[model samples]
Target: MDCPAGVVTDNYDIVEDDELWARIGIDWSERSERSERSGDGLDNELWARIGIDWSERSERSERSERSGDGLDKVDKLDKLDSETVASPTQRSTSLPPELLRATPLYEALSGWCRHWQGSDSEVELFHFSRPVNSIDVFLNLGVFGVMWKAQWKAYEGQCGSHDWQTSRWMKLVTLFVVFNSQAAALTSLLLSAALGFAEVYVGAHVLPLNLWVFCGYMVFLVQLCFWQRIRSCFVAPWMVFLDKMCIHQTNMPLKQQGIDGLGTFVKHSEKLLVLWSRRYFTRLSLGGTASLVYSVKLL
Candidate 1:
C-alpha cells in the first residue's frame, strides 16, 4: 500500500526500534547492555509496559548469550566438587549457580530468556505480511452489513450525505438480538474488509487459520493492529466501534454510558451499517436496537 508518510508500514520491526523504546521511557543506554547479553529480546516487564504478552514476540533461543565472566564464574563453582580443595581466592570467587542466577543482572537477563515462548496457531496468520490500500477500499465499497444497501442508499439520497462521505470515521453497528449468535464469518469478513483484503485472503495469507476455524484472539489482534495503523495514517481510516466488543455492556454503569454515548458516536459518524437479521430485533433490550434508534435520530 502506498501510504503517505507517517502511516504505519508493513514492516512491524519499526515498532521495536529505538524511537519507540525512547517514547516508552526506556533508557536504551542502560538497557543496551541487556541487548548485548540478549540480542534485542523483550522481557516480561518490557512486554507488560507495552501491553503485549512476552510470548507474542517472534520466537528465539533462551539464554543464548551468557557472558564469559558468568560462564567462568559457573566453572569455578564446579571446581569445588573436585577432591582437591581450591585456594582462598578461588573459594572466595566461587558462588552457587542459584545465587548467580538470583543476582539482579543475572535475573534480568534470565527473565528476558524466559519470556513467553509459546506460539498460537491463529496469531501467526494475522501477522501482516504486506500493506494494502485500506482507505481507498473502505471509501469505494464501504463495509459489510446486512442492512448496508438500504442504509447506504438512504444516506446517499440525503442532502448531508456528502459530508458523511468525506468524514474519516464510520460507524459499523453489528446487530443481532442473540448475543450467542454465530459471528465467525461476520468477524472474519469485517476484519478483512477493514484491512483491504477479502476474508479468503486474510485466512489464506494474512493470518491463516486452516479449515475456516477462526480464533477470537486473532480477531482482537487484527482489530488492534488495524486501529493502531489507522491512527498513524495521514487520512485516518474509518474506525469500527463495535458495541459488545468495544463497550462494557455487562457492566451496568459503563453499559448505560456506552448506550447513551451512541448518540454522540453516530453524531460524528459517516456511515452507519446495520447487520440486520432475525436475531437483531429479538434482542431489542440488549442495546443494539437502542443504538440503531438513537443513531437514526441524529441522522
Candidate 2:
C-alpha cells in the first residue's frame, strides 16, 4: 500500500530514527543538509564563563590605582602629629611701681591739663588735697589711662583711612576746653571768695601778698589744665559722631543707611551719657556721705 501524505512509511523509518530527525520527528535530511548555518555553538557559553573574571579584574585594577598607600600614610602622620600638640607659654609684663601706683587714666588727664595750663603745679596741689582720696585718684587715673590708650590705638589705626584735619575731635576738644576753662575760672573765684570770708569770720591771718600771687597763678594754671583734660574727654564722642557721619556720607546710594547710622549714633551716645551721669551721681553721693560723716565726727 502507498504511504499517506502526512504518514511515515518503512523506507523513511531509517531517516526518522536518526538523532537529528528524531529532534523534529521528520525525514527531511536532504533539505536539512542544504540549509547552511554559521557560528560556534559554544560561543555564548564561553562568553558567559569569561565575563565574570574580566569584570573582577577591572575592579581590582581600579582599586589598586586609587589606594595610593604612600600618600595615605603621610596624611595619617600629619593628622596624628597635629593631634599631639603642646601647650603655649604664658606671658606677663609688669608695669613700673610708680606707674602702677599712679594709674594710667590719671596721668593722661594730668598731662593734658598740664599742657593746657602751662604748669602742673595746680594739679599737684589738688592731687595732694585731703578730699582727693587714694581710691578716687586710683580709679580716676586708671580709667583715664585705659581710655587714653584705647583711643590712641584707635586713632593710630584709623589715621590712614581718616582725615586727621577737620576731624570732629578738634571740635570736641575745643568745646570741652572752652567749657572747662570757664568752669575753672568760676571755681577759682568762688574758692577765693569763700577763703576770704572764712578768714574774716574766724579772725584768721590773711595770706601774704606773695602767697596770694602764687595761689592766683596756680589757680589760673589749673584752670587751663582742666580745660585741656575736659577737651580730651570729649574726644571719644566726637570720634563716634565723625565715624557715623563718614559712613552716611560714603553710603549715599542706600537711602535709609544714613538714617539708620544716625539712629545708632544717637543710641550709643545716649547710653554713654547715661552711664557718665550715673557715675557722676554715684561719686557725688559718696562724697556727700563722707562729708556728712566728717561733720558728725567734728560735732
Candidate 3:
C-alpha cells in the first residue's frame, strides 16, 4: 500500500473520516438504543451528545521496527510518545504502591486523554496484574478453567484498574497470585521432602511409603513445569481503557465524554492488541475495529 498524505506541516493534518464516523455512528449506536429503553432524559441526552474530535499527531513508530514514521508531525509525535509511555526504570504497576501512586506511565497516557478531550480532565489508564502463580491457580480454576473465580476477580477488579477504584483494590491481585503460586510450590516441596527422606535415610526403611520415594525427582520436575504453566497466564504490564473501569457509569456528562473519546483513545494507544480471534475484522466491518485498522493504514 503506497499511502501518503497532504503537504508537510507542523501537524499531520490527520482525519478520522470513516473511522471516527463508523465508531461513533455504528458501534456506539447500540448504547443509544439501550439507554433509550431506560427512558431517562439525561441518558438519551448523553447519547445525543456523541461528539467526534480528531486530534492528529505523529505516533512514535516504537511499536514496530519501522525505520521512520514517514509523515508530517512524526518527529514531534515521537517525542510526545516517548514522554507519554513508561520507561524501563519507572517501576512496575504490579507493585501495590506503584499501582496507587502517580507514575510516569500514568502521566503519559493521561496526557493523551487531555490532548484528545481538549480538556485538562484526568482519566485512569488501565494496568495489568502481576505475574500469575501456578501453585495457587490450580487450587481453584474459573470459567475458562483457569484460576479460581475469586482470584480472577482480583485480577479484573481487585487490581484497581479503574479510576473510581484508585487505591481501592491496591495490590490484592498480585499478592493473591503470588500467594497461590507460592503456596502450591510449598506443598510440592514438602511432598518432595517426604519422598526424599524415605528413599535416602537408611533408618527410614521402616517407612510404609518407601515405594513412593522413587518418584521424588519426578515431583521436582512436575513443580518446575507447574510454575511455567502459571507464568503462561501472566498479564503483560500496561494501562488499558477498559470500558467497565475507565468510563463513568452514573455521571451522564462524563459518560458521554468517554463515549465520544473512544476513537481518540483507539487512535492514540501505543499498541492495538490483536492477539485473539475476537472476530476482529467482523467487528471492524460493523464499524469500530474497522476504524482502528483503517486509521492505521491511512496514516
Candidate 4:
C-alpha cells in the first residue's frame, strides 16, 4: 500500500508521517504496539540504546546500598565502643603528639621569625621585640633623649641671653665644690678602714667629716631637684605657651584659630609631661630608688 503524503516506513515495519513520528522515526502503528506492550519499556530501551546499560546501573545501585549498610554497621560499632570505653573525665590529660612538639606560643612567635631575620630596619626590629621586651627599653630611652635635648637647648638659649662668663664661673664652682667634698670624705673613710687601726678615728673627727659629706651631697641633690622643677614648671610651660601664642597669632578663621590654639597647647603640654615623667622621673625616682637600695646594701 502506498504511504500517505510525508509518510515513511522503516525496516521495523513501522509507518511514520511527519506529524506523529518526526521525533523518533517510528510510525504511529509501532508506537501504539510498543505502548501496549509496556508503557515505560520504550523509554528504558531508548536509554539502553544510548550506551546506558541497565545491568551496570543495577550493579551500581546495589553497591550503593551495600555501602550504606556498611556505614550503618560502623555507626553501630562506634556507639558500642563509646558505651564500653572509659568516661570522658577519665581520659588522659596528656597533650597530643603534634601539639606537644609545636606549642601555641612557639607558633605565634614563629610567625614573626621571617620579619626579624629578613629585615635590616631597626624600627621594624624595635616593633618586633615590642611584643616581647624591647618596647619598654626603647620607650624609656626615647623619652629621656628627647627631654635631655630639650633641656640642653633651653639651657643654651638661656646662657646666650645672660652674662656668659659669670654664669660659666658659677656653674664651675658649684660642680667643683660638690664633687671635691664628696670625694674627699669618701677617700678619708676608705683610708681609715684600709689602715686597719683599731680605735683610730675619733668621734670628733668622724662626725664633722660625715656631716660635711652629707651636707655637700644634699646640696648637690637639691640643686638637681631645682633644675628638674625649673624644666617642668618653667621651661616646658614657656615652650608650650609660646607655641600657643604663635598659633593664635596666625590669620586663620575664628573657629579654626581657636581649635589650633587649643590643639597646639594641649599637644605640647602632653608631650612635655610624657617626656618629663617617662624620661626624668622614671629614671630618677624608680631607677634611682632601686639603685639606692642596692648601694645601701653595698655600703
Using lDDT as the measure, name the better of candidate 1 and candidate 2: 1
Residue 291's lDDT in candidate 3: 37
Over 1-299, each residue of candidate 3 has an lDDT whose tens digit, in order, gives 11123211222122223342344453334444543455431233333554312221113223212443233245468789999985422221122222221112222223222322322234333222221221121111101112112211011111111222112122223323433346456756788787667557845556656566645556554443344334335742234334433444456665554444444333333433222222323432223333333334323
lDDT per residue for candidate 1 within 111-221, as digits (tens), equals 221211221122221111112211111111122252222121111111110111211222111211111123434565665465545445555566544633445447644
lDDT of each: 0.33, 0.31, 0.34, 0.30
Model 1: pairs clashing at backbone N, Cα or C within 3 Å = 125-206, 125-207, 125-208, 126-207, 177-279, 177-280
> Of the candidates shown, which would achieve the greatest lDDT relative to the real structure?
3
Q: Give the TM-score of candidate 3.
A: 0.24
Output the worst ten-in-a-row residue range by lDDT, candidate 3: 135-144
Clashes of each: 6, 6, 4, 1
Q: Which digits, one per residue and each the tens of the lDDT, describe model 4 over residues 176-283?
A: 343234544555565555433423555545455544445544554444323323334544211211111122223345324332222222211212211112233333
Model 3 Cα RMSD, 1 decimal: 21.3
Candidate 4 local Cα displacement, residue 254, angstroms: 7.8
Residue-level error in angstroms, candidate 3, position 232: 16
The residue ranges of model 3 lying beyond 4 angstroms of the native Cα positions read: 1-238, 275-286, 297-299
Error of 2 at 229 (Å): 6.5
Q: What residue pairs are clashing in model 3? A: 126-239, 126-240, 136-180, 284-290
The ten-residue window of minimal lDDT in model 1 covers 153-162
